[model samples]
Target: MKMRIVPIGDQATLGDHRHYPGARLLLVCSLCGWDKAYRAERVIDRLRELKSGGHATRLEQVARRVAWNCPGCGRVKWRCHFAWPPGFDDREAKRLANLYRN
Candidate 1:
């Protein structure tokens, strides 16, 4: 699979998760060195519960809807990126899990 890096200013939507299965969103605070990883699906679900209509929400637009401030420093200097775990293959993992089993 080809890996694509979408610029922060690009219009990559939450729904793009379909194209990059198992990808996670990594948020890092430049001021305080705080960092965390969020599953794409959970983020989407949370946005839906908040009635934010996230499926069509662009990745660049999420900062406006979600709080990106660093909890430790109370600053909004954040760096966000889409990432996958080291040496983890999404396709192989899905195949082994048999997610469609009834």
Candidate 2:
């Protein structure tokens, strides 16, 4: 399966294949931080790791909730930039992207 990596300025959001079905193998996006590339499953693994470490990131952020982050203060506050999913609105994701690309 081809990796489906949603592009971002620094990191790409990973879509889970094993959990979400029809998932790609490796998500290749220069925006994807930490590593040059990332596997969808691997992203989940790391998120879970941090969760176990008491630095849990929300699933929405894990699912690409937001792209813009306050880099200056983020390092000190953990995943403070992440926002909670307001509700079911796939279009919101698109709107967010539209706002970003423009």
Candidate 1 pairs with clashing backbones: none
Off by over 4 Å in 1: 1-9, 30-33, 89-102
lDDT of 1 by residue, 1-102 (tens): 322333444567777766655567766676786767787788889989989767787776665555656788988877556766566675755864565332
What TM-score fits each model?
Answer: 0.66, 0.26
Task: Give the TM-score (vs. native) of candidate 1.
Answer: 0.66
lDDT of each: 0.66, 0.35
Model 1 local distance difference test score: 0.66
Off by over 4 Å in 2: 1-16, 19-22, 25-37, 52-60, 63-102
